[model samples]
Target: MSPPPAVWVSGLRKAYASHLALAGVDLAIPEGEFFGLLGPNGAGKSTLINILAGMVHRSSGRAEIFGFDVERDFRRSRQMLGVVPQELAYDPFFTVREFLRLQSGYFGLRHNDDWIDELMAELDLADKADANLRSLSGGMKRRVLIAQALVHRPPVVVLDEPTAGVDVELRQGLWRFMRRYNQEGHTVILTTHYLEEAEELCSRIGILQRGRLIALDAKDHLLARFTWRVLTVTFDKDPGPLPETLAGFLSGAGENTLVLRLDQSRHSLGAVLTALQDLPAQILDLHVQEPDLEDAFTDILGNMGLEQP
Candidate 1:
């Protein structure tokens, strides 16, 4: 039998005065799955995260973490979950080490030095363990936030834009650590506008648009929904005009490059190459871009509320 879901949200609805923040969103995240929540600003990603963290009460519906209802068993449910919110909230006076100890204290843990040191090392913050929170750089502070969330060793971890404003190397390192954690039975749920991160890290993804769950499925299945491919052809010089054969296929045009949206069923790459062979200018470069999570998100926003075939 399949293991029970670590996090289950059903018919989750939330509203603020007249505006709906979440509309009947339902999600089932299996144990050890790396889940992603992708959405643009104002798409209610924060609201959903808050609801799951027990920070914001839902207007209606239910959310459960490890069989503990969020509403009825708020403390227990929260104890099993760790949330690193988008905003960095910390006490400036405390050192990173003390901060983590305080967080561990809240969970009623004593002498968690082994786990705390392990977390510090994994996040590359062991050197700054005794440094005050105010003395650390933004990147270092973010690492502290991550360590604090994991102080209790929660089963489920929710990261809301954790890599924002961080360097590429750190971002890669974070993902690597997350992958190792998930492999070790931790259920990780991430919300990021960085489509590339979602594409690389998540096994399953959900797209939210205008306060609704627009799409949800495995990464491959969701990517398959974006059926169009884009080709960019840059000319050595302005071609002056596109060829007649290429005109109908062109979706956009830049100063020296033309963008074509090709449907595999109707046209092949060979045909496109053939049409551009006789162009006036030399082909400076050719790039074929496949549809990714961002393309799927754009499609979802455009086709929201419609049944996609």
Candidate 2:
């Protein structure tokens, strides 16, 4: 028999008084897949994640982790799932090692020092192993939270805004670790405002809007749907006026530079070059950028008449 999905949600809904946080979301993430759950603020990404983690009760529908119902088999489901929340919650008095060990114990894992040590080394927390949580820097503390989530070696991991306040170097490191973990046959679900990161790491993406999933597909497919290209041209001299044909395509302009948007099916690179050649200015540099995840995301939301967050 095939293995159960890493995460499964059917008609999931959550209501807070008059507000409905989730309006019947249905999703399934297979084992070993790196999935991205994206949305603007108040789109219900966190609410769904909380329900899967058993931290919040769902108002309706069902959620499961590895086929174990989140509510009916809470303990078993929780044991197979690891979550890194957006907030930093920790016992300041506990040392890094102590905190991780305590988290392992909570999952009924005894003598899990081997995995704890491995996690510390992998996350670059070896030096801070004995330091009190209160003494660690914010970046170090974040690493500790990641390690704490994995203390029990859960097969499914969920990270919500893990790199929000982290520096570029730390963000790169976190992705490296996550990529390696996912490659080893573990499932990873990520939610972030960083479209570039999601574009690079996630195999599939689900975008939510106003408590409903508006888009879900492979990263490449989503990007391909835009069918647009960005052309950035730097001129050697100030071009006084753009030809009417070229001017209509201009998206932005700066000092001796022009940015144009091209619809792939309607416009060709050769045509753009010919238009530029007709101008009185010499082209210093030109860059043609393919449509990316951010562009697709913006276009999708715009078409739906929703404001991006």
Candidate 3:
């Protein structure tokens, strides 16, 4: 028989007194897939992840990891999953190596030093191996958190805002590590505020809005839903005011630059170009940018009469 889905949830809901953090979310992630969970703050992304990690009890519904029910088969399910939490929780007294060893021991991995060393080297934490946890910089600490989560080499990994507050270098390093593991048949799931990161890393994305799953689909499909291409033009002279015919498409106006959104279905690029040529301002340069994940995400939320948080 085929192995069970890496993660599966049905009607998952989590409520806290006055707030319903999750509202009946149903999702299934197959093995070897890189999934992105996206949402604005207070949109229930973290709550959903907490429920799946068994750190918070759900108000209703079922969740499973590799066919093991998260609640009923806690040990097996937990063993199959690793989570790099949003918080930086660690003991101050222990050295980096000591802390990692303790984490491995927690997972019944007393002889996991080889893998621990590999994690440190890959994450650029090898040189700080003997430093006290409290002495490490924020970026170094984040790396340790990532290494801590992976000490057991779980089949499924969930990185909750893994790159938050980190430098570009650390962010890229983390992405490479996750990408390599995902290619090796590990399921990688992450919740991030960076739309560009999600666009580049995730194959599938699920967007949450105010405790509800508003959108879920392949990244490319979501991007395709955005019917407009961005048109940016730099003019040799400032255009005081655009003509009535072109004003509707003008999304942004600068001293000598105009940025417009041209809908392929309703407005053609060539037509827009022709209209620009007729403008009072002389165009010096122009660029047509294809729709991206951020555009699609904004459009989706806009159609729902909601603002991006």
Q: Which lDDT values do the candidates have, in the order given?
A: 0.88, 0.93, 0.91
Give one digit per residue, the lDDT tens place, for model 1 in 75-142.
Answer: 89999999987887789879989989988999999899999999999999999999999999988888
Best model per TM-score: 2
Write candidate 3's Cα lDDT for 127-238 as tens digits.
9999999999999999999998899999999999999999998899899999999999899998999999999999999999988999999998998887788799999998
Full candidate order by TM-score, most accurate first: 2, 3, 1
Candidate closer to the true structure by lDDT (higher is better), 1 or 3: 3
Location of the lowest summed lDDT over 10 successive residues in candidate 3 = 238-247
User: How much is 223 displaced in model 1, in angstroms?
Assistant: 1.7
Which residue ranges in model 2 land beyond 4 Å of their true spot? 240-247
Question: What is the per-residue lDDT of model 2 for residues 15-134, given as tens digits with 9 covering 90 to 100?
Answer: 899799999999999999999999999999999999999989999999999999999999999999999989977898799999998999999988999999999999999989999999
Q: State candidate 3's TM-score.
A: 0.93
Positional deviation of residue 45's Cα in model 3 after best superposition, in angstroms: 1.1
Using lDDT as the yardstick, the better of models 2 and 3 is 2
In angstroms, the error of model 2 at 80 is 0.8
Residue pairs of candidate 2 with colliding backbone atoms: none
